[model samples]
Target: MRRMPTRAKVEMAAYGASAAALAVVPSMEVLPAHAAAAAISGGSLWWLYRKAKTGDFARTIRSAQRLLGPVTGGVVYAAAAAAPGRPWWEIAVALGWGGVMAAWLPVTRSTWTPPAETGGPGYPPGFTGLVMRLWDDAEVAPGTWLEDIEQTVSPEHPDFTADVVALAGKPVPRLSDVDIAAAFGVPTACVTLADKPGHGPGRLRLTVAPTRRRGGGIEEVWAEVVARPGGAIPGSKIVHVKTFPAQGDLPARGMVLAEVEPGEVARINHEQLCSAFGVKAEELRLVAQSRGREALVTLYESAPLKGARRATRELLTLDAYGRYTIGTAHDGTDAKVHMQSAAGTFHGFLVGVTGSGKTVALALMCAAWALAGLANWVTSARPDAQMTAVGRHVDRQGAGAIFTWWMLKAAIALMDIRGRINGEVGHDFSGHSPYPGLVLVLDEFNSLVGDEALGDEIAQMTDVLAREGRKFGIGIVFAGQSLNLSKLGGEASLRDQVQGGIGVVLRIASASGGIAARQATGGLAGDVDIAEIPDRFNASMSLMDRMHGTVDDVPGETTQGVGHTVTGSEAVMMRTLYVHLPKDGSPDGLGEIFPEGGGINTLTEREIQELTELGLWHDWTMPPPSAGGDSGDAMPAFTGVEAGGGIGTLAPPPVAVKAKKATVKEQVLAVVDREMTAKEIRGLVDAAAGTVRNALSDLVTDGKLRQVDHGVYAPVHAPADV
Candidate 1:
């Protein structure tokens, strides 16, 4: 026989395997007669399998069997094969066997298998459900242990202890003291159990009481459980449970007390109070409640009699309390000063190290007083007197005039007080009107008058103010790095004059003397050593009364005279005047007294003409007439004469003609420098191109620079110099 083809051999092998599979399947077992329908149904499945293996329709039939499975699928396959059937029963039997095989096929044998009896990796069945289901499971029984557990546990069960325990292993011990305690979410000492009242089997009563642990009381509850004899298992009943918070427990309270009374109390926590007042914490004493109350009361009630208005203004107006109307200006004109004082008198000394804002405080006080409609009279002997003479003069001329005469006089007098009077004495205006009543802010008072030479004068001034200023409404504010009563000649007298003292001790050389002593014992009567003053303008001022232990708003009365308060506006004006005053011609100096920025040499030709017309200039002359037969034999000659002079004196030369040349040059340069380019120089000069170029080149060559880049020329030198 010829060797069979590989395809034919494969087909024969497949058919033989199918036939063997069919034969083996039916012989295994058969459904009973009652299961005959099932058996027949299973036979149809075998037929379909044969169809799937033998025909092109095999994959579809197998897929249909897979989707429809077993019984229902066998019926469909049997019907399809029997449409032209040779034997329906045989087809039925074959289809039934196929259906049975399909139904029992292990499709997932490679990928998955049934878990072992011990179960899979996750929690055993009913673990969560077992916890929930155990109550229903017959082994544990419902309502059996619930009551017993409820006895030791809470009906409103705490989350941590709601657990199930199997009683099969051993006798169920009554919930442990720890477990019972945990069930109530408290400590073990808080829980206890008692046998049931009737001593029934497995019955108990539990009481959970609060425990005093960690110094805090705990709430507690009580419950009872009685076990009843049952058919399956002993059942439990919750008799009673009660919950209540611990009694006799009070909330914790702060230990601080309202020890100090409201009136005249000195707060011990003065640093805290000062903080509230927005001042340096170290500037005040820390007192206990009683002392703090006393101190606070003293401060609240204290007032300076002489500087009452000033004190009120500072405390009320400038302070955190008073809401006084702040006037924009004196009757709506230019704002002159910041009026802060209600009564208009101020008396205090400002003490701070150099650059510690002492000067600024004085200025602020003066301004406040001036705004209050009181004149501030600052008298400083220091060469830098700008801060002291703010509103003393109006314009530069007025400032110059005052500094030339009046300032000089005041300086000379001050020098005389220090025994340094060098020249002849000038006019004394001690008895003048508008006696500047506001504070006489004297800066660097120690330096103004040498210690030895002017001690007496300083003492005398202090005495005068101490003894008589209140009567005259004159206030004094002495400022310095160091202020000593001895420097003023007498401690008692000096202290008497300065009832209201402010000390801003940036760094104290010795706390025992000077402002330290006065500030320590003055109004505040405290040992406050200001190590440094802050940069804020009035930061140190608020501590004045506290450091001195003085009462707020209580002005100290001095026998001197009525104290004058300085307003903010006047202080600003004085500062402006001081700043504007030329250094050399300042009132405290003996420099040239010419008007500021308008000296003799700076006088314009027109000004000179005006002066000459007014007969003010000493040297002014005119040119002679041109010789044109009108004054035959006339000779140009000089004659020293004055204009508008008496008979025998020749009429003075015309100043206009004498100043004409300088005047014309000045006017030309003025116009050219303003808007002239190099190209436009000739038009403005009204001269030939060569002449204009020469003048322009000359101006540039002389160091009167111009904008070369823009081709615009301006005078590099001072206009007045030009």
Candidate 2:
């Protein structure tokens, strides 16, 4: 009774419990044996679990030696019990030999060994041997998983590693600790599961012990698992041993300190870290607090981003901080992305050519933000029917009937004043703005940039906003066709900062998309693979949606809007949510009132009435064609007409066969055979408001037309004589 040690007590319990189990297994007769066998197995598991909790072992051998005694000895004891007529001395000798072999094996020079085990928590029987023999380059075979498996573009990793480690009945292992399991006899366990969600299971790993060799390890062994007969590989983890510098760059904690030589810190920068680890830099996590002065870089591999969905209302919940999910990453992760969701107002530039669905994408993004309760404003310096539709649901839809440059100029001016007000209030301004989450959407940004005078003012506004307004919760959405960061109105600092700022940039397919990608993302456009996006949205809309409706008659494909999303230095493939264009036909009688259909209607009935009250209506009207009886039969107004003109009822000269009308683009390109004012082109083509300007810009951009001076455009292939 003199204070038996805890280790001795555990050993006694294990020996007594295992012996009882063998004694019952041979009795095989009936209920008593069954009860006894179950008790032995359950009791052994409970006892081992408690013993594991009792003490920690630095090496696997120490712990395995303990379990090795019980497990291997139990097998021998069972064999002896099963031998019907074996002599008592023979049985004793067999048990004693097994114990002696177990005790002496560790002292012999050998490799990581496995201990025989029945079963324990989290780990199955034979798990140690399985991991020891087959932990590397193993995959979960197809049939082992559920049959109704949701096969994705990528496979999934299993979550079985933690359980295996837990079942190993050892204390959790540290990075430097040889802690794979006490039974596997090795000190490491690493499992790389399926990157795709619903990942299947597999274990991959290799242990490397470094020696004096430079850039070469001393000894390396592959921990490959062999599948059971007719069984699939059970993947639980990937394992590898990391080598760290022995000195200061020496790894104290889990991280290996990359060399911090002069300028070497930056030279071994984020990309270098990713390259060293062989993964996307975004997958790596930098340790914030390292024990040593040297920084330790940590790489964390989570589920790869994937299974992007369409725009949903749930994704529209953004805080005043301007955080919003425009869409998900193509890699199938749970990460939500916000454009320029920083502390204050910054700029996000979106570039895509016409038919690239850029406008629709921008519109939907803005709508998502607005629905999220973020105070968003819009401005289109180059106002058009499409842009008008995009902004219809937002704050810039004619508050006080304001539109175009009025809104654009006012937004910029307000940002300046707000910046001033913010300085008076405080720089951070209590976490957000007075009107928090103010997103000024600059639609058709290149038009503003195209203006020699307004471009400078806009650039000046951008510099200030991108500088101070972001602190005041003022963010800007810069959208245009083929927007180039370097060509953003000669502001080098502005371009540099924005290109490197905290906003998501989307580069869709375009003529100048490559330029924007190179300038803004500093990456190749070829990587985007726009062609992969199928033309999936060709289905017809309702007749109403096609005619008087503002919805796109030819709806954009779900995949067509796919682009490259650039968040700082990293770029990932992304697909913007499909935009359901709103129906925004002009109100009935609106065209009649406008007459010219460009600016506000000069001949509105209200205006006409007011003019009549002021006696100006009479002046504007033509005196009702002179009600004085047309002054003697209207002075024979048709005198020059031939007598045959009177026979208009005679088939109207075969109805003067009409020709099919051509598109505004065709007309513009043909007429640009000679120099002409935009006004002349408008009169000739009679296009809609903003249509001529868009066409002109397109013609210029496409090398179809050259602007000789303001408003005058001549065909690029026009004859010199003309």
Among the numbered candidates, top TM-score falls to: 2
For each candidate, what is the lDDT? Answer: 0.35, 0.43
Tens-digit per-residue lDDT, 1-722, candidate 1: 23434544444444344334333333334334225545656666666666677767746555554434345533543344334424435445554555454334433221233333333223334223333333343333223343322111211222111223334443334556775554445677655555545544344444444422231111121001111232100122222222222122211111112222344322233333333222343221111122232211111111111111112233212334222221221111121222212432245555455443344344444444443344444445443544524433211111121122222222222222222111222322122322333345555555544433333444445544544444344455666665644444455655444543322223223343223433532322133222221232222335557889865554322211111112211110001111123334345321112223322122224433543443333311213322233445543422223433322122222221222344323544767655457777656666667766666667677665554446667666535323
Give me the candidate number with maximum lDDT.
Answer: 2
Cand. 2 Cα-lDDT: 0.43
Kindly list the per-residue Cα lDDT of model 2 for residues 297-363, writing each as its tens digit. Answer: 3332331121235555555455455555555544333234454534333456676655556666666
Candidate 1: C-alpha RMSD to true structure equals 30.8
Against the true structure, candidate 2 reaches a TM-score of 0.37
Which regions of candidate 1 are displaced past 4 Å? 1-345, 385-436, 451-455, 500-722
Find the 10 residues in a row with the least total lDDT in model 1: 568-577
